[model samples]
Target: MSTYSSNQEQFMYQTIIKWITDDRWMMDILRNVRSLSLPDSWVCAGFVRSKIWDQLHQIEPRTPLTDIDVVYYDATDLDKKTEKVWEQQLSRIQPELPWSVKNEARMHIVNGIAPYDSTVDAISYFPETATALGVRLDEQDQLILVAPCGLTDVFEMNIRVNPHFLQGRGDMETYTQRIQQKNWQHTWDRLTVVDS
Candidate 1:
């Protein structure tokens, strides 16, 4: 069962799409990722989450991202070096941007989980519901959102642990440490951090 109604989901989806569409820098970043032509790729995590939070906070001059996380699924080649090469490519294109590219195919080994079915599946296992969100630009340049946990928590500015992290599949200590390290509440004062 969905935590939110379909109507609410649609509204959030449209709102997010509109926000990204209106931001030229975000669109250019999407274009650069698209140029790589990686299969089932997206700019995920803080890239999309921070934008919504910033807009909700009504902050100006957008919060600078620590890194631009570009994720993709390619079961054929799981080489870590290739991910670095892609990151270097992105850096060459936009020297100022902090790019971090990862092949989700090999990430399972690092996360100590079974191989993910796809990039979206990998996102679903992210620590927080809000951070699990991903965005990509389609061939038509239309925004595509992959929200395995839905967008209610993000739109509502609520920070909740992803069930995947709560389950035995993940470690609570790690999740707790991440929340503390991120200190997201300090930045987005309107946020509500939920405990499970």
Candidate 2:
């Protein structure tokens, strides 16, 4: 028996799929990113967050993205410099695209936390559960979603900090600062921001 995503999750995933299919650039970017075949890789974070938020806001599908974050996990090589190499390669593939590559293996040191076992594990540490989502294209050219925190907050346009980030006082402060700085409400006025 093949288990499937919940109906709501399937709806959300279909929305993303339609949006990406409608845009040539988005499909091209995913294809290029997948070409690299980095270990356990996914184009995650705002790439997924902004799209869902944009759809909820009922705005044009043309939300300006600051960076396209490509996160991967490779235990054998934890060298930070390798991420830069990946960035350069992506830049060459699409000069106009804003690409940010990160390796989850060494990110624990940068984040001052224990090592993350995989890309999904690192995504869970993201400040907001809504933001802790990822998507990628598999070898079959099918879209695959890896949302560790589920799709509830994002689908509801709720901006609440993730419980994981609440453990550290510093993390809480950083999350607050990020909420203020992002000011997503300015753009998506309908958003329900719960700042704790």
Best TM-score goes to which candidate?
1
Scored by lDDT, model 2 comes in at 0.82
Q: All candidates' lDDT scores? A: 0.90, 0.82
Write candidate 2's Cα lDDT for 1-196 as tens digits.
1122689877876777777666677778889999999989988988888877777777785688999999999988889889999999999989898899999998888878778888888888788878888888888888877767777788888898888766522367777888899998898888888765
lDDT of 1 by residue, 111-173 (tens): 777888899888898899999889999999999888888898998999889997566257778
Estimate the TM-score of every prediction: 0.95, 0.91
lDDT of candidate 1 at residue 79, scale 0 to 100: 93
Candidate 1 has a TM-score of 0.95
**Candidate with best lDDT:** 1
Query: Model 2 clash tally?
Result: 0
The Cα error of candidate 2 at residue 1, in Å, is: 20
